[model samples]
Target: MPMVPLLICDDSNMVRKQLLRALPSGWGVSVTMAANGMQALEAIRQGLGHVVLLDLTMPEMDGYQVLAAIRAQGLSAKVIVISGDVQAEAVRRVLELGALAFLKKPTDPQALHKVLLDQGLLDPSQQTVAVSRAVAEPVTSFQDAFRETINVAMGRAAALLARVLGVFVQLPLPNVSFLEVGELHMALADAQGNAQLTAVCQGYIGGGIAGEALLLFHGSEIADMAQLMQRNSADYSDMEMLLDLSTILIGACLSGIAEQIDVVFSQGHPQVLGMQAGIDELIRVNQTRWKKTLAVEISYSLEGHNIHFDLLLLFTEDSVERLSRKLAYLMS
Candidate 1:
């Protein structure tokens, strides 16, 4: 039998390598790799592979786009979706877009092998290592601790928002990173696809720590948010609703996070960065102003509703060392 073509797509080199390692090395499969959605689609069009291992959150393009391209062009490639976003809604979205399977991150080898076998893509004669599942949980590190810390804070924020609007909010897995400021916008997968948005910015300082919190909403979110607040959509301006929503969500979230970290924050008034502006035009500061920053991002959506938004908290590079110390203290 001829070797089958398999394409691995992910932005992280480490993840791609891990995916390769998880497979049987002796299988008659020719592996090709792509770093992002565009590259993945190009490879498929070029006939480099017929089976794709696609990741959801990537800079430049996301898995949804790649899957859509596959469906549009009548490509024969089969896609298995992989991501850390375990929300049932997120999984359902990927499957709805033409993915053949979904696997959450840090995929158990047993489960992965089972997926391949069930898909009839695994060769029974191949030799593969039965790796042990003895590794400590990946979410145990300081980074992950910070993620969990913000996750709890996010839940509090959701509850507060729910009470204020009397509507349930769809929570997402928070993404935390220490990355270059120029690369910050690329970190938001849910927000990047929109053509236009309205964003609000607020400053906060306390306990010798300072940073900015950004609340972004898709252009269509204003109506849903206003309706949730039980207001006539035509009565208030979009900016008014945007600021009000940002104040409630960002204020509660920041306070909850500060309390957990044993700190305090004095928040500044919400500033309308832009209403109905492209994301690139929303940033009031220079892109490269800070070489790097510590950031926490949460993509929040309303359950059974079309409302969705993202919250990004960015701290200057100088503050991260101190922040790391605080995270370590909390871990202890």
Candidate 2:
């Protein structure tokens, strides 16, 4: 069978190139690129490409909107979403909207190749894993090791969400960093942007490691979430779904991290921070309590919807020393 035309879409120049560059040599597919949802939609509408390698989080148009448009127009393109939006709801939403496959961002060459093979988009005899620099080299750096560890945990969280929502979750690049709370907003400026936002803060502590997991949702995306949760967009329904989404994503994420480090976190009740346009203004918590925090941020986007969110697993200063030692153990 002839390989189908592939359109790689993402806002990041590196990611777009990574997807295109990682393709196997002599693969019979034609390739193209799109930087945003609008551009992706236009490309598909104009028959520029049929098989899309889509990114979920983008300005103007996101993967969710592009998937929605593809479904609305009944496009015949086989869309495979390759993004970092690992939320379970996001995965299920896109497949429902007609995605052929869902792969995580900075996707594995083996995984990408497998999707193509299974979809009959490539001849299996000629398809082989294309090893790229993007592959994890855990022992090379402490950060890389932790990223891999969290990447494993992120997959566990995604699997849980997939089971519950009956959808495939897009695994995102887990951001492992050391920063002060005041510095976090700038670090995540692109993900948060100027969109109105809502957040769920859950505190976790165990084995001398303690911190908060903050799940931030786009305010305008609440209605889409309500619909995904199969509930009316009433105030009560919204709150209920918000709580439900928080419990699953946060719980699974924290649990995955603890399981890897061989520790357990006693979680506190999730606090809803409500909605506001200004992310800094919307958060009511004091940042100065901790001089620095270990921030593990995952930017999540729901496929086939106009929503993108972040799951920030923030560890306190005192806990970092202990957490570092524990994380170091994995590298041994």
Candidate 3:
């Protein structure tokens, strides 16, 4: 029997490795892994991908563009999208672009096997073997594991927001970095660029993990946000709207993360960090909070609307070791 040409494409090394570990042991397949859409396309063009397992949120190029490109060039690769972006619109778009199936992140091995067999991509005889639980590869870094964790949480938060607002939420690749206080300020400044903002901060701590979650909104977009929420601008104060949004997004996002890492966070009361202020002003006020920290930044926008917001999860420097240990347990 010939080995099936299987390709797994995802931006996170942890997730790619997870997929590899989920494959049926009895199925004969030569696996190829791509870290991004560009590499996935290059491998496909070189005839390395007969069955492509793809991810949606990625740098350089995303899975959506890859699907479109595959269709345009008439590639025979059958794509099964494995993504953390589980929004209805995301699923619809990928299916329309020619993905064979859409599986949520942290994919179940039995579910994946079923999809392969149902799609006739796997032989029926392979079903005799149960899925493997062995960790086939080491996670490349703590950052990859942490970012993939937040990616799933980010999708949950977005899905909740979308359901409440009756609008599709556009998700970005969650950026994870460890930086000094000064570098953190510069990064935030570059992202906001002097725009007036309303922001809230809430702290969470439990089981040796502690961090602050900051939700930032552009002041100019408040009116559009009010319109979407069906609240009259004159009746609802801007502060009220900002706090409401922060509670929904920050609370949901943090809860999602805690669920995945097997911890519960007792959250501090949400505090208004700044209203109609610049990024520098906000950072200056809170500069003494930490010397260096791990920051996970995610931006979300409402489809067909002018509403946008950014969520930042800042874990203290001392918490990195705890986080790495927790991630190791989860991956195991």
Candidate 4:
């Protein structure tokens, strides 16, 4: 092959750079970059993407949309999806939509290399420049690195939940922000809308990282959740369903993050913050306890179902520097 035209599509700058560095050293390819699906489609249209590496959760257009477009437009781009969303449905859907393969997040270089070789995209004997400089370059900042970390953790959580519920989880682009108590209230309002909500809060502390995990469920959706969980009406109540969900999502998500940053956390007992309360009421009860926080929000929806919930990871302001140091060490 003279040169393969490859496109790397992901919203994270860190992820894009990592993929570039992960390319086979001797692969003969001209690489194009896209931050979202629209750009990826445009690049393919321009003949810049004979091969596309796609990430699933992105703003504007997601990987699923890109795959659909590639099929609809009769484009010849061979798409290999790379995403943190590891749900079984996610993999099945990508393949069904015309993706050549699906790889999990925080990609393995050897695995990627093997895939390329197996797919005849690489020649085993070829030798090219090493990615030493790319290796040396750390992620741009703590925020970007932290957000990407959450992105991966979010997927792990969703995957577990999807497995337990036997439903496809629709993932959102994680929302990360540093906010004051007032701003946090506003953000919660936007997330929950006017729905009455029930929430569970759990605190975790270790390795100089301390925060609370809050899982919010819409009041009207608890019955839907109960149905999906296949709960015995005589055996489980709405509150039981809520706590169970909190345990699965919050535990898996925190464990995922901890595994990446090399931290071990001791978790506090889950507290029922409120049931059938408005967003304002929920925040008011906790307002005095939080001043400033680093908040990571993930809204997960069940495919073909009306069930949706928001999981918020709130790190204390004091924990930011310690977490930053941890990420810096990991990236380094």
lDDT of 4: 0.84
Q: TM-score, each model?
A: 0.54, 0.55, 0.89, 0.90
Q: Would you list the clashing residue pairs of candidate 2?
A: 64-304, 84-172, 90-302
lDDT of 3 by residue, 106-222 (tens): 899999999998899998886565543332464667888898999999998888888878899989999999889988877777656645676788878988888778888888998
TM-score, model 4 to reference:
0.90
User: What's the best-to-worst order under lDDT?
Assistant: 3, 4, 1, 2
Per-residue lDDT of candidate 4, residues 1-332 (tens digit):
46778899999888887888788877877888898999999999999899889999988998998999899989889888999999988898999998888899899988888888887777777646442322233355777889889999989988999889998888898888889998887877775564577778888998988888888888899899999889977778878878888988899999999988899988887776644444567567657656888999888899899988889998888889889888875354
Per-model root-mean-square deviation over C-alphas: 9.9, 9.0, 3.3, 3.2
Give the C-alpha miss distance for residue 177 in model 2, angstroms: 1.6
For model 2, the superposed segments whose C-alpha errors exceed 4 Å read 1-138, 185-195, 232-235, 275-289
True-structure lDDT of candidate 2? 0.71
TM-score order of candidates, top first:
4, 3, 2, 1
The local distance difference test score of each candidate is: 0.73, 0.71, 0.85, 0.84
Error of 2 at 96 (Å): 18
Candidate 3 local distance difference test against the native:
0.85
TM-score of the candidate numbered 1?
Answer: 0.54
Scored by lDDT, the top model is 3
For candidate 3, the per-residue lDDT at 328 reads 90
Count of clashing pairs, candidate 3: 0
Model 2: how far is 45 from its true place, Å?
Answer: 34
> How far off is residue 307 in model 3, in Å?
2.8
